[model samples]
Target: MNEVKASMAGSVWKIVAKEGEQVKSGEDVAILESMKMEIPIPSEADGTVKELKVAEGDFVNEGDVIAIIE
Candidate 1:
């Protein structure tokens, strides 16, 4: 399994990939809003998204697990 982690502390702005969705490496899985900027969290592995650990508007810190892929 691979964990998709947050790149910075922020509120989740949007989820681009859903559970059970296939994703490739470098694909944006979620977007985060911080300091008026939208930062994208990309998946580092190519696989199906197994779980989402956060929802839109949820606050997350850097290195927090956003999703699990396998």
Candidate 2:
């Protein structure tokens, strides 16, 4: 399993990948809004999305686990 963590503190703007969805490496799985900028969060590994630890509008801190892939 691989954990996809937040690179910076931000509010989750959208979730582009759903649980059980297959994702490729570098694909945007989520988008975060921080400092008035849109930050795209990408998958580091190619796999199915096993879990999403956040929801839209949820605030997250750096290093927080956002999702899991397997």
Candidate 3:
């Protein structure tokens, strides 16, 4: 299993994939808003969505696990 973590401190703007959804490498899995800009969070590997640690409007810090894949 792989844990997809936040790259920077930000608020979750949206959830693009649901649990159990199959995702491909480089696919946008979530969107984060920080510094007044919306940033796309892409998957580093292809896998099924295992868990989402946060939801829309949640705040996260860099290195915090946002989701898991396996």
lDDT of 1 by residue, 1-70 (tens): 9999998999999999999999999999999999999999999999999999999999999999999999
Clash number for every model?
0, 0, 0
TM-score against truth, every candidate: 0.98, 0.98, 0.96
Better of 2 and 3 by lDDT: 2
Choose the strongest candidate by lDDT.
1
Per-model lDDT = 0.98, 0.96, 0.92
RMSD of each: 0.4, 0.4, 0.6
Residues 1-70, candidate 2, lDDT per residue (tens digit)?
Answer: 9999999999999999999999999999899999999999999999999999999999999999999999
Decide which is better by TM-score, 2 or 3. Answer: 2
Clashes of 1: 0
State the displacement of the C-alpha of residue 66, model 2, in Å, after optimal TM-score superposition: 0.7
